[model samples]
Target chain A: MKVVCIGAGNVATHLSQALYKAGFVITQIVSRTEENAKALALSVDADWTTNPDNIEDADIYIYSVSDSALGEMIHRNPRKNGLHVHTAGSMSLSLFEGYKERGGVLYPLQTFSKGKAVNFKDIPLFIEASNADDLNVLRELASGISNKVYEASSAQRQQLHLAAVFACNFTNHLFAIAESILHEADIPFEVLRPLIQETIDKTATLSPREGQTGPAVRKDFNVMNKHLDKLTDHPEWQEIYRLLSQDIINNHRG
Target chain B: MKVVCIGAGNVATHLSQALYKAGFVITQIVSRTEENAKALALSVDADWTTNPDNIEDADIYIYSVSDSALGEMIHRNPRKNGLHVHTAGSMSLSLFEGYKERGGVLYPLQTFSKGKAVNFKDIPLFIEASNADDLNVLRELASGISNKVYEASSAQRQQLHLAAVFACNFTNHLFAIAESILHEADIPFEVLRPLIQETIDKTATLSPREGQTGPAVRKDFNVMNKHLDKLTDHPEWQEIYRLLSQDIINNHRG
Candidate 1:
């Protein structure tokens, strides 16, 4: 089936490439900039377009644009007969109203970094469609690309996305904080690699609650105060240490 | 070398087993209970003891007990000639004062769980010996069991431990929070596994700051507030969501 991908950012780049690799005909690549569109279009052996008027006949048009731009992107779409699917976690299927009768979502519940290689087969695909026929089409396409696919309503997907913000995005920020602390102390960040690996590995067998250790889980205030005092120079980090440690304490023991 | 483990908790269990496996003769396993001590003692083919008066002479006495109980455990140790070391991250070498003349610290900076096998060679071993001779002994022993061994000052190791709380302990709590969020929504926790793995994997090559992504890094407060609103049923979680995302925004663009 012919697929046209709109937007050429990280999600768009990864999703378009994966779809093309899975034998979907990437008929065109669309982006606001000619350069961005052409870069992705050339990679997928498809035509490039900057004008919304240049959009062509395709089985699906993936609006992989940002959440802020979804409305404008949908407003400019010229295709009236194709499946208008989005790759947003928080957007409702109703966004495609008056744009297309066959509206759906094919949100890949994973972070995508452009120019980085990612195997889409195991990345859980959360999909939603406005109609039965559109849902079937999405299920087939998603199944071909991924082993794990679930049809979630917009509400559930929004919650999942919020959870990802905690699980993925905030976790990465905490790592960044740890990196800064290690860098300031002239300690090699690599020293913590094994511990970090084990931290995640334990979650496979034990629940995160069961895997918790160190001062916060044990509610050792001495260690918590020491950690806070060490971060006194960075007051923001100190607050974070206090707040998160307190949360853990209250959640576990309270 | 002859050794005695003074506790049978997670760290004590793993460290004692690893030392025994590395050909150290575990002379005794000492705990408050004969049953608990004997369990570990049998695993290493060592004598078990609840009474500190029964402690035999060993080259090293490892105090792997809890932080709160370290003082009491130290007071109970009858040995006066051995090299006394601790396997605690946040503790100082001064804790060994008056307990042993040859004292030090042999902190294995990793989370240990009972019944789980972990490779000692990969786990970072942080050592802080009280003297030159004990330092050399710790260096030799730590190097024998672990490839990643570092002779760190108490201050440096404390900072490392603090950073670890952020990276390992707090990150696991975030996962627990995520699990709860997903649970309430009836979403499967496995959906976030690939994302979690990639978040850590990227940190291996990219600095965690460079690896940061999502609305927080983008300074997209619209979505951040949306997430907070979705978490209305969970006030504590909402606060965490707000605080972490705000910290990310402040750190990146500040």
Candidate 2:
């Protein structure tokens, strides 16, 4: 199979690399930036291009652009595509509306950071296509790189995207808050790592609700008040502490 | 060193087991119930008793009780001569007021769950003592079990505890929300395991701020609105989603 990856961001780099590893020939790497496109193209042994008009004929065109840039990219859509696919969890399949007969989504529900090597096989790929054939093609491509592939409708994928925000993004924000708090206290963030690892590890064996701990889950007002007082300088963090604690109480208590 | 562990809860169970593994002789296990104390005592090969009064003359007495119950427990505080410690992250070291000369806090900055075997060597142990002699004794014990041991003050330990709420408790709650959202869509929660693991694994290499990626950080109101629309039935979850997303935008954008 041949693919033309139409972005050079984290997702694009990782996705294209995974596809290349899966025996797919990335015919052309298209990005407005010369360096990023050429760099990834060199790594994947693909021809690099700065213009979408120069996109090579391929079996699949995967647009792994940012959600915000997706609109700006829609006009630059590669014309010679056998099948059009995007790797966005939030986006609808309608992004490829004009090519309704031969388009779909191969959304990988995992965070990809620049310079970080992602094990695609561990990522859960949510596949959505307009028809069975396109989906099967995407599924075949996804299955080559990943063990987890599921058929998710646009609505279901959207819900899954929201869940990803909570599971991956928001949980990460909490970790950032932890780093911030520890930074202020002159304590190393390393101290909390084991606790964080155990917290995540518990989920594989226990429900998150059942695995819940600390002041919030127990609704220990004393400890909660102490924590709130400590966050006086960080009013935004203080507000978060209050809201999440309240929600945990309502969920667990009720 | 001789020890008496008061309480048979998660913290107590894990702490006592760790102490036993470190070759400390747990002279007696004290709890309000025979079954509870005996169960833990049997595992640690120590005598069990339902009375705090029966707490032997051990070198150190570790109180691993709840935050609310700590005050009530101080009165039941085992009268020992060598040293006294509590495994609470929030409580002031002054809780060992009467034994001020020979008491401090030996807080393990990790979440303990029933039936889960935590490797103490992986957990961070925070030691705080009112005096140098008591400090060394506590440090000696803590260092034996945990590789990551630090002398943190009452205030610093309190901050660490609050940070753990964000890193562990709030993170786990977000996971619960993810599970709920997936449950509603009839999707298996296992699909999210990889995403969750990566979310955590990223923290090991990247700062949480740098690791963050989502619609919220990007301030993509279009996608956020779509998510809110999908969550119409879950107003509580919707409110949570809005607040957290807004906070993320403010923190990252500012």
Candidate 3:
């Protein structure tokens, strides 16, 4: 199938490459800068264009752009020879309300980083659309590259995105906070990697609730007091420590 | 080497089976209950004892008992022959003070569940001792089963344990909260599994800071506010969402 991928950022790079690898022809790649679009287009053997209006017709055109530019970009490109889709999790399919009768979503529920090769075969793609035919088109496109695919409405997808904040985004923040604390103490962050992997591994077998442990879950007040005391010099770390510990205890006990 | 396991709970079950698999002799399995002790002992083709006083001498005595019971358990039975080691993370090795001079720590940093099968090779064992000989003995023992072993001081191990609360325990709580929210909304919690796995996979290749994504990291106030509005009926969840979202933005912006 011929494909046109809009945007040259992380998602675009990963998605276009995966689609190309899975035997889909990337007919065109669009970006604000000619150089940006040219780079990804070259990698996928697709024609590159700086102007979105210059995008050629294809079986599917994916607007894998920022949330703010989604509506504007879709509005500017009025001619839709085929189905048009956006990859943004927060933006609804309604953004293409007047743009195309065949509009849908192809949201890959994974964080993408440029220059890294990701195996999309197992990565879940949450799809949505305004109609059944468009849904089928998007599903066929998504399922071609990945085995894990689901049809999520805007509301469900947004909730999933919110959960991703807690699970992925905020969790990474916690790691950064940990890295900062360890940095201040001259501790090597490498030591925490195995623990981090094990923590992630536990979720596969048991619910996090069942696998919960530590001073917080055990309610060891003495050890908790000592950790708090040690953090007296670092108020930010102290606040996180206290509140998270309390939250774990309260939630686990209840 | 002859090893006497001093508990038949989660740690003992896993450790004993692993030691047995590694061609080590389990001299006896000691526990308060006959069935538990016999069950573990039978796995390693060793004797079982319900009384600490009846604990047999071996090359090493691994105390995998509860943290609350460590003090009394040690007082009840002095290290008769070989080095003594306790597997508690937060507890100090000095808990065996006044006992024989061979006391040390053999704390495995992973959460162990009784019925679950854990690959000991993947578990990182944190070993510490008051003296070099004890450390080597523990090292030799730990190296038999796990490739990852580190000599961490009690203070450092305690700090690592505290950090584990954030990375492992606290992170799991966040997962639980996410699961609960999805459950409350009648959404299948399974939808988030692939995203969860990808989040962990990304952290291995990139710093958590660079890997952070979602509404908070993107600073998408519209989506954040929408999720908050949905959480209005659950004030507790709302507070958690607000606090964590703010933390994500604060950490990323800083």
lDDT, candidate 1, B1-254, per-residue tens: 88888998889888888888888889999999778898999999999899888888999898999888998888888879878888888888898787668888988889887766888889889899867888999998888788888889898888899989999999999999999889888997778999999988887678888778999888777788888888888888887787888888787775
Order by lDDT, highest first: 1, 2, 3
Please give, as one word, the docking class of candidate 1.
high
Q: Write the per-residue lDDT of candidate 1 for residues A1-254, one digit (tens) a residue.
A: 89989998999999888888888889999999888999999989999899888888899999988889888988888778878999898888888887677889998999877556888998999999977888999999999889989989999999899889889998999888888888887997778889888988898888888888889878788888888888889988887787788888888885
Instruction: Please report the TM-score between candidate 3 and the true structure.
Output: 0.91
Model number with the top DockQ: 2
lDDT on C-alpha atoms for all candidate structures? 0.87, 0.86, 0.80
TM-score, chain A, per candidate? 0.97, 0.96, 0.94
All candidates: TM-score: 0.97, 0.96, 0.91
lDDT of 2 by residue, B1-254 (tens): 88888889999999999889888899889888788898999999999888767667878888888888876676675574768788899999887676434778999989888977789998989999977888888889999888988999999999999999999999888889899999988887789888888888888899998888988887789889989998899888898888888878888875
Winner on DockQ (2 vs 3): 2
Worst 10 residues of 2 chain A by lDDT: A72-81
Poorest lDDT segment (10 consecutive residues) of candidate 1 chain B: B95-104
Candidate No. with top lDDT: 1
* Clashing residue pairs found in predicted model 3: none
Residue B51 displacement (Å), model 1: 1.7
lDDT (C-alpha) at residue A236 in model 3: 67
